[model samples]
Every structure is written in structure tokens, then in C-alpha cells.
Target chain A: MRGLFKKRRLLMVVTALSMLVLAACGNSNNNSNPSASPSESSAAPATETASASASESAPIEKITLKALMHSSWLKGGMEAVLKDAVEKTGITLEIEKLPEGTDGDNLIKTRFATNDKPDLLFFYPAVKESDGLGKPEEQFVPQDDQPWMANFNKDVWIDAFASSGTFYAAPYGGSSMAVMIYNKKVFESLNLQIPTTMEEFWALSEAVSKAGKVPVYLSAKDAWTLQIPSLQSGAAQDNLQEITDNAYTNKGTMSDFTAKRQGITFLKDVVDKGYVNKDFLSDTYDNAQKALANGDAAMYPMATWVMTDISTKFPDQVNDIGSFLIPFNDTGKNMAGIFPPSAMYVVKGSKQEAAQKFVNYFESIETQNIYFGSEGGIPTIKGITNTQLTSAELDAQKLADEGKAGPVGVSPSSGIPQYVAGDYPAYLQDVVAGAKTPEQVQEAEQKELVKNAKAKDDPNFK
Target chain B: MLKRQYYRYSMLAPGFCIFLVFFVWPAVSNFFYAFTNLDATFKYTRLVGFDNFISIFEDSGSSIAFKNTFIFTVVTTISKVGLGFLLANFVNIKLRSTNFLRSALFFPVILSPIAVALAFTAIFHPSRGFLNVLLQSVHLDFLMQHWLTNRHIIMYSISFVETWKWTGLTVILFLAALQTIPKELTEAAKIDGATSWEQKRHIIFPLILPVVNTNIIISLIGGLKVFDIVYALTGGGPGNASNVINTMVYKSFSQGRNGEATAASLLLFVFILVLVSITNKYLNKDNRG
Candidate 1:
């Protein structure tokens, strides 16, 4: 009886193993069928032009394109655009949001590296060789031939990814410029004018502190925010073009770019002067905005997106907020720092027809109006003219129109690796906490640049 | 008889295949990748040999990570073991609230580390946190700290949270082992005119030495492998001041320096193996009883 029972149990185990192997084979068969359908449907449209009406009468074949986006890109009229694009085009977007900061960068890079690519990727226009996405020309399907390219404002929106003018991504959002989003009520109450030089800016800060309010609120907890003041100062420098070009390669160091280091020094000086809030390290961007709106703080150095964010969230205090460039030097000619529009790149050989159709619909003037109208900012596309600008928005635009705004920080052509560029905020935090001096931060950055340059097999470092 | 023996060995087939595919394959691949210049670019791959390991040793950040990891491990292991033993003894006593206290003490161990870290993030907030508020209310204002911001104390703050979360498990393990000791041994010590402290020291303490050894090793291994709490809390920052080896490995991987990250992970693997083996051998030496 024991021997018979053992035989029966062995038979059952063998049967279970056979079933598991069969199930694994069945899964692979199912996955291949969907990938083939996109190409079949794409071919059907071209061949069946005469029978287009009949094809339309039949059920519309829906294609779902997976889109990977940073959590930060989820804001700024993204929901409306995503929903509207699906409705207009037959492509359904399966959106996956990655975490902000270095974690998100790792996820996207790994996905690209492992060939676990999504159909669409929401990213910056610039593609660094070291950021894991080797070269945009090879990794992405170019959109230069798309019909929307004719309408795209080429003069205003420079395709930094396309050095050869072979566009691989499309601009789908408004640009953001770094400015000091301050409380006009506090400024007016203190009878202070906007400072044009470093000395004047300090005098104003000192005045605000005496009035029992925080002079400059630094949201140091969010490491990204720490680099804004320095980047804005760097943008205002007359030799910015030279600095970025030389600093990125092994040709120049941070010590040579005095303007860039001035920003870090400015941050250190603010902490030393006790002009910032006591809880700068723990204070987040959201809390800082609230403090600024509630009149607890006088000024906040941030980008233009906060203008619309503050206006929408604090409707009552909308008129009381304003923006201006941060004066890092005593030169009296500081310029606003502008970041290019965030873009969407199509992965090579994946749902290209559906992805392109969705991109075309998204870049239309009507859709652009819908986006910029809700999320107030400077539109990168040509036809959106009636955006309702906030007071702070107008102030930043005024700076840009007066030829006082230029590209800031690391541009795509800056040749600085994205990972190395990303470390600037962390280094600034080290400086803020008094763990490292500005010179040490510069030295640390120089070491990182050389190490990454060698890794990229750059001849300059050799 | 041979055919029946073959049938019996076939039972091991399914489990062995799974182990080979999942665990062994990845571990072997990790070892292989550690030697090459693998990165996110994936364009060129070649064996750079010990260069990846050499780079890790040279980097200043890696040194800081090693130092921070050491401090975190020491602080967490000691606190978890020490506090867990104290709590276990308290609940082991016969009292009306014994069951309730035991349940409450073990509850935190079951909580998610991410959720626990997030809760502590708010508690450690410098200005508006519950901790600072409580301190201010009690007129202990001077005791208030920049918990997550101050570079010097950030690792300790993270270690404290880790200790708080895992101590309950340690307590339960110690409790189970403590109960195994015969009550007659303590009672006999008491009859011999030994005080409570003396009874605990001579009888109860010596008896629970095995459990103590086990708890220390378990806590030590846990502290060495910690990643989630540190990542969720500070992200190894205030300028990498609170970085552990795992977070540094993550940062390296994120920066597309895959080879260096893999090398660091292998180093971490060997470090754990050597340390745990030595500790296990030393602790078990007195276990003949």
C-alpha cells in the first residue's frame, strides 16, 4: 500500500511539472500577437485607401502605447493632454510615472539599457551620451518628417538634441524660467525696489529681515531647488557660453568660471547672514510657497511654473506675487534663466504609427491652446497667443523680451554628463550644511567631470 | 531497485531547477558583470578587470559611505539587542496587561519599512514636526534637533527608526527563548538568599546566553543589509552624509556606472559573508551545553 501511494504521488508531481512548462509556452505565444497587430494595422491604412469608409465602419482597432514619464512631468496640463490625445487618436496611453530625482533617472536608464522600452518617453530635449541613452539620433525615431514640424516654432524652440537638425523629439509643453517669486505686498510695505546688483539685493534682504519676515526662503530639503539661485546667476554672466563649453570638457575648471561659483557663494552667504529661514534644510517647495503666499516669508527664488501654481492654489493672493532675476554680482545687469520645454521622445521600432498620430494631435494649435490656457506660461509653439498670463508670469516674460533671459545651467551641447550635472544640487547641500566649502564643492565637481569624461572615452580627457 | 531510486531523485528536480534559474543565475551574472565596464549606454562592454574595484576605493564618497554604514550597523545592532532584551523581560512578567503589551510591542515589526520611514520623516521635520512640538510643549526646547538635516546626527536618527521598527521581532525571539528556561532554576536561586538582580545575573542571564548570541548575529546581519529605511528617509544625503553601501550602490547604478555598482555590491556580499561567518563561529564556541 505504501509503495502504491508513493507511485501515485510521483505521477501527480510529474503531471504538475508538465502543466507548468505548457503554461510558460502559452504566455510567449500570447505576447507576440499584439506586437504584430500594430504593423498590420499600419499597412492596412495605406493599402485600403479606396475602402477607407468600410474600414472606418468596422470596429476601430485600438492600440495602447505605454508612456514612461517622470513624476514632475505629471503636472502642467498633462492630464488634459493625455485624455484629449486618446479621444482624438485611437491610441490609448498606458502611463507609468517614475519617481523624481536620481531614482527616476535610474529607472528610465535601466529600461532603455535592458531593451524594456516604452512606446513614448516624456523627457528633456537634450540627450547626454553618458545618461544611458547613447545618442538620440540612434535611440529615437526622428519626428522631423512629421506634419507638425511645419507648424513647430523652430526659431524659438531650438532642438538641442538635433545637432544635425534631425529632430527626434517634439516640444509639448511651455518653457519655465528661474526668477525670484516674491510677495509684492511685502516689497511694497517695506518700500523696496527690485535690486539690480548684489549689494542692493543684500540691503533689501536685511530690510525684510528687520521687518520680522524671512528675507530669502531656500527650500533646501528639495535638493533641486538649491541650484536655482546659482544657475540664475550663472545665466546672467556675459561669458556663460564660454564657461559652459570650457567647463564641461577638461579644458576649464570651476575656478575659471567665477560666475558659476558666485551662485554657490551666494547660497553660502545667505546661510551665513541668517537671511533664510531657520528650517531651510527641512522646508519643502510646497511649504515655502504657502509661506510666501501667507506673507510669512518675503521672497522665494524659483522657476516660472510656480506662478501658475500659486495663482491657481491661492486665488486671493494671486495679484500680490511677482517675479525678478536674482542679482549674483554687483554688475547691475542680471538676466533671467530659461529652461527649455519638456518633450516626448518615441522609442525606435515600437508602435511608431500610433505614437506619431498621437504626437501630431498633441502638437496642434487647438491642443496647445487647451494646454497653455489652463497652465499659464510661455508657449514654445507658434500659434498659441491668448494664454492668460499671471502677474509673475508677465514679469518673467518682460525679462525675457528685453533680451535679459538666456539658456541657463547645462545645455544639451554643454558636454557635461547628466549624472554629473545632477550632482550639483547635492554638492550645494553639502555647502549649505557647512560640510564642504564652495572651493571643495568645485573640486568635487571637477573630479566627477574627469571621471565621467574618461568613462565616455572622450579624447579630451585622454 | 535502481529504477525506483531514479524516481525518488526526480522529486528534487523541480526545486533544484528553480534555485538554479532564479538565485544562482543572477548571483553568477552579478559576479561576471562586476569585472566589465558595463553601464547604461550598453554600447561598448569589455573586461576592465580590477579597475571598477580600484575606482571605488579611490572615490571619497565611497569612503564616507563605508564610515556611515559602520556607524549605522553598530548603533542599530546594539540598540535593537539591548532594548529588545529589556522589553522582553518586562512583558515576560505575569501582569494583567501582559498580552496587550506583548501584542503592542510586536506590532511595529509587521509595519512596512517605507511607511515607517515616511512617518519618521515627518516626525524628524525640524520646525513643524510632532517631536519638536512635543519638546517645546514640555519646555525641553534645547533638546530639539535638526533631525534629518544635521549631517552628524542624520545616520543616528535613521538608526533609531530602524531600531524602533525591528526591536519587536528581537523581543519576541528573546521572549520565546527566555520561556524555555526552567522556573525552578530562578526559584532555587531565590531560596539560596540571592537577590532579584543576583538571580537574574547568575541563573536567568547565563541560561539565555544562546538567545543573546543569536539575536546579536541576526541584528548585525540586518543592520549590514539595510537599504529601504535610509533611502526613504534621507536618500543618503545632506551631501551623502548618511550614505550606506547599498545606497551608494544604487547611486552608482543610477549614474550609469553599472560596473562600479556591481563591484560595490559584490564587495558588500563578501563583507557580509566574512563578518557573519566569523561572528557565528565565535558565538557558537560556547554552545556545547
Candidate 2:
């Protein structure tokens, strides 16, 4: 009786194994088919096109492209936008968002370490070669070979990846302008106009304060939030080009953020005057949205990304928020500062052809117009304008039209520290907390940036 | 008999292979990477030997992390064990409420550490958080201070949260050990003119020494390797103020400097080993005697 039962179990196991093998084969066929379709279907272009359209717009083979990115990118209308993007690209997307900051970086590193890379990665643009690695191409494939390079805004796009003359990623939307998003209702309720200069802005803040509302929602709990006024000041520099050029060469100093420049000092002004949110140090990104939606804070300095979050959380106030560049200049001139975006990269040794095709489609003006607003940044494609502009984006567009906006980086070219606050966010936090004076913060930043340059074995390092 | 023995040896094979695959292999690989400049990209790696270790020491952040780790381990171990021992004595009494009290005390031990830390984050929020609100409500507004952001007290605030969660386990362990001590031994000590403290010192305490050793070693190891609480709560920040060794390791790892991260981790491993060894030896000196 036992032997008979064992025989039946063995038969069942064989059947399951056969089905598993069949399922595995089916999955491979699905992923590999898209790579072949573009070329194969091209030969039969007219007939294939007709057949594809007739077949309810479904591609001959369905494929899932694995994409990894920061968790924050998933918010706003990003899902609806990505769904439309994936439909357009003829491939489905399987997205995994890593935690923000260090956790995300570590998780990506582990994926790289195991050689279990995603096919498509939405990540910060950086390349580290310590002058020790023999050859860079052993790990990465450059976009110089990718066909879509011809369409990008050449000057801006080429430097989006590593500054090493080896481009490896696709540039989509990058910040060419940052704006201070405000509640229009609060402005109207308090009877105030958006100020155009730093002095007027402060005066406006004072007016907002007297009206019994938070003038500025400073979510200082997030260390990255401390970089805004400093980055704005970077944009205002007449010597911004010289500063960024020399920063990688170990010649950059904290004096780059001089008091006369009005970025960091502007933050200090707000802090000193108590124009910053009372619970600024404890309030988070989400809390700021609630505050803004409810008219608790009249103004917040953030990129366009906050628009979707506010709109989603408070659908009623979607049109109530307006945006404008922070007036950091003494003359109160409105100017916009651009920061880099976390871009999408085609992973080497994956379905490269399919990934690149999807990327090519995704970067087109039509696709990017939608993607950029979801990211709360401007499109990197030269002529692509975000069509679904929030009141804030329209304000940014006005600045862009005047040619008053320019791309700014903490270190734009050398990639020493990709983000403006890369090495000095903590020091900025120290300054904000009264633990360190601005001079002290500057000295510490100078020391750390130099250290970072050397650590990366940057060519410009002294 | 020989066939039965062969089957027994075969049964051990699966478990041994699991240990080899999961624990030994990764540990050995990590130790190897400690000597190499293997980054996240894995595009380039060179054996840099002691350079990685030297760099860790040279970085000022690592030193801060090391100091934070030591303070966290020492403070949490002493507090958890000491408080657990006292609470164990209180709850081990023959009373109905004590039975309920034991359950309530042990309840936190079952809750996730990350969940606890996250809750405490809101509790410790500077303005709108529960702690400050409660303080304001009671008109002790002067006592309201930044719990997680104040640089001076950030580590202690984290340590207190950690202690609050794990101290329950220690209490249970101590209570079990206390229960194992005979009522007769305590009664005899009391009849011989020993006070409650005297009875505990001479009778209950000596018998519970092994359990104390166990709790100290467990908590010391936990304290040394603490990661989730700090990661979820402060994230070693507002500028690395509450950074411990594990958080530092995570920072380096995220930066794709595998060698530096592994070197930091190896140092942490050695620190934990040394702590465990010292406590184990100190407590078992009586057994050796």
C-alpha cells in the first residue's frame, strides 16, 4: 500500500516539474520577444503595424522591464503617467522604489554587488573610478552609442552622467528652475502679492506672519531641506561658472556662499526673524503638504514635485497653490536655479535593445512633458514643455521664458558631490541648529569637499 | 545499529550545509572583502589590505560612530539588566496583579523594534509630537525639549527607546530565574534575621547569577549590533549626531565603498566579540571557582 501511494506522489511531482519548466520557458520568451519585435516587425512594417493595431494595440509579445528608483518618485500622478508611458513604450514596467538617502544607496549597491541589476534604473547620475580601476567599460555601456543621443539638448544632456566624457545614462527631466510654492488662498485671504526680491520677500513673510499664518514651511527635519537657500545663492552667483569649474579642482571655498550672495544668509534671516515654521525642525515632507493644503504655511521653497503631493492629498486645493523662484538677490530680481535630476539608466548586460527603445520613447517630448511634472522638475529635452503645468510650473515657465533661469549644481561638472549639499548637508544642519557659525560651516564644507574630491580620486583634485 | 547511525549522520548533513551556506560562506566572503576595494559596481576591485582599515580610523565620522556604539552598548546593557533585575523581583511576588503586570511588561518584547522606534519618533517630535503635547497639557511646558534633534541627548533618547522595548525580555528571563529559586531558601534566610535586601543579596542573587550572565551577554550583543532602531528613528542624522558603528557601515556600504564598509563591520564584530567574552568571563568566574 505504501509503495503504491509513493508511486502516485512521484507521478504528481513529475507533472509539477514539467509544468514549472514550461512556465519558466514562457517567461523567457515574453522578455526576449520585444527585443526581436522592433527589428523583425520593421521588415514587415505596414503589415505588422496593421496587425498590431488590429490586435487591440497589444504588442506581439508582452515584456516587463524592471525599474528601480527612489520611493519619493512614486508619488503624485507618477503612477498614471508611468502607466501611460509603459503603454506607449510597448513594455510593462515592474518598479521597485528604494528608501530615500543612504538606505536606497545601500540597496542599489547590494543589487550591483550581486550582479542582480534591474533592466531600467532611475538613479542619481554618478561614476566613481579611483584612478585604480583599469578600464571603465568593463562595467558600463555608454550612451555615445545609443541612438537617442542625437535628440537631447546637447550641451545640457552630455554632462548629465559622469563628466568623464563617457555618458552612460539617459537624461529625462532635470531641474532648471526651483520655485517657492505658496497657497494662493492664503495669499488672497491675507491680501498679499508674491514678492520679486529678497527684501520684499522678507517683508512679505513679515506680513504673512502678522496675518497669523506660517510664512514659510521649513521642513528642517530632513537634512536635504537645508540645501535650498544655499543652492539658490549658487544660482545667483555672478561667479557661479567659475565656482563650479574650480570646485572640482580643490580650489572651491565656503566663501562661495558669501553673505552678499543671499542664499544661506537668506535662510539665516528667516531663522533669525522666526519667519520659518515654528515646528520646522520636526515637520516632514508629508507634514508640509498638510500645512500647505490647509493654508497653515503661506510659502514653501521646494521643486515642482510638491505640486502632485499637495494636489493628491488635498484635491480641493489643487489649484490653490502657486509657485515662483526664490528671490535671493538684494535687488529682489526673480531668478531660477536648476538642480540635476535622478535619471533613468539602461543597465548593462540586460535587454539593452528593448531598454534603450523604451528609454528613447520615454524621453521624447510628448512622454517627457508628462514625466517631468510627475517628478516636479522641468524636462531635459530641449523643446519639451510640461503640458499639465500646475500654477507653480506656469510661474517657472514665465522665468524660463525671460532666460532668467539657468542650470546650477553644487558641483555640476566634476561629480565630486553630485548634489549641492553633498558633503556639507550636516554642516548646514549645524549652522541651522546654532551649533556652528556660518564661517565655521563654510570652513567645514571646504574641508569636506576637498576630502570628497580626493576620495573619489577626481582628476581635478589637487 | 550501524545503519541507524548512518541515518543519524545523514540527518545532520542538511543543517550543517545550511550553516555553511548561509552563515559561514557570507561571513568568510565579507572578511575577504574587508581587505579588497570591492565597490557596489563590482567593476573594479583591488586588494588594499590594511588601507581600508586605516581609512576607517582616519575618517572622523567613524570615530564618532565608534564612540556612539560604545556608549549605546554600555548604557543599554547596564540599564536593561539592572532595571530588569529589580522589576523581576517586584513582579515575582505572589499576587494577582503581579500576574497581570508580568504579561503587560513582556508585551513590548513581542512588538517589533522598528515599529516601536517609529512610534517613539512621533512621541519625541519637537512641537506636535505626543511627548511635548503631554508635557504642555500638564503645564510642564518648560520640560518640553527636542528629544531626537538635540545633539547632546539624541543618543540617549534612542537608547532609552531601545531599552524600553528589550527590557521586557530581560524582565521575563529574570522572573524565570527568580522562580527557579526555592521559596524555602528565601524563607530560611528571612527566619535567620536577614532583611529582604539581605535575603536577595545572599540567597536569590547568588542563585540567579547564571541568568544574569545570560541577560547581560544577550543584551550586550544586541546593543553592539543595534541597527534597525537607529535606522528607522534618527537615521544617524540631523548630521550624524546619533551615528553608531552599524549606521556608519550602512553609510559606507550605500556609497559603494564595500571595503571601507566591511572594515567598519569587522571592527564592530570584534568589539561585540570582546564585549561578550568579557561579560561571559566576569559572570562565570564563580562557576570557575
Candidate No. with top DockQ: 1
lDDT by residue for model 1 over A1-462, one digit each (tens)? Answer: 799687869778786986798688665554432233445544554234324324667554556778889876776576777677655555678889998877787888877765567778888786556657667776777887888888876655553444345677788577878888899999999999998787899999999999999999988888889888776877767766566677676677766666667778988999999999999988888888899999899999898887777876898998899998777656666778888877888776536656666788788888888787678778877878658688898999998999888777644353344336337788898988888888888888787777766666667788
Question: Could you tell me the lDDT of residue A107 within candidate 1?
Answer: 82
Please provide, for model 2 over A1-462, each residue's C-alpha lDDT reduced to its tens digit, 9 standing for 90 to 100: 697577557656655665676688666654443323334333343344345546764674445668788887665445656688656555677889888865676676666555556767776664444322212354455677565666665566455465466776677455545668889999998788877676788888999999889998887777676666666556656666567666556666656656223566666677889988876767787888888889989988777666656666787887888887776665544457665656677765436555666777776666666666555555556766554566776777787788766555533555444312233666666666666666766765565455444444456664
Candidate 1 C-alpha lDDT tens digits along B232-272: 99888888888899998987777677888899999999988
Q: Highest TM-score: give the candidate number.
A: 1
True lDDT of residue A9, candidate 2: 74
Best by lDDT: 1
- Encode model 2's per-residue lDDT on B196-265: one tens digit a residue: 8899778888888888889989988999899999978987877768889998887676555667788889
TM-score of each: 0.93, 0.83
Task: State each model's CA lDDT, in order.
Answer: 0.80, 0.71
Poorest lDDT segment (10 consecutive residues) of candidate 2 chain B: B37-46
Per-residue lDDT of A236 in model 2: 57
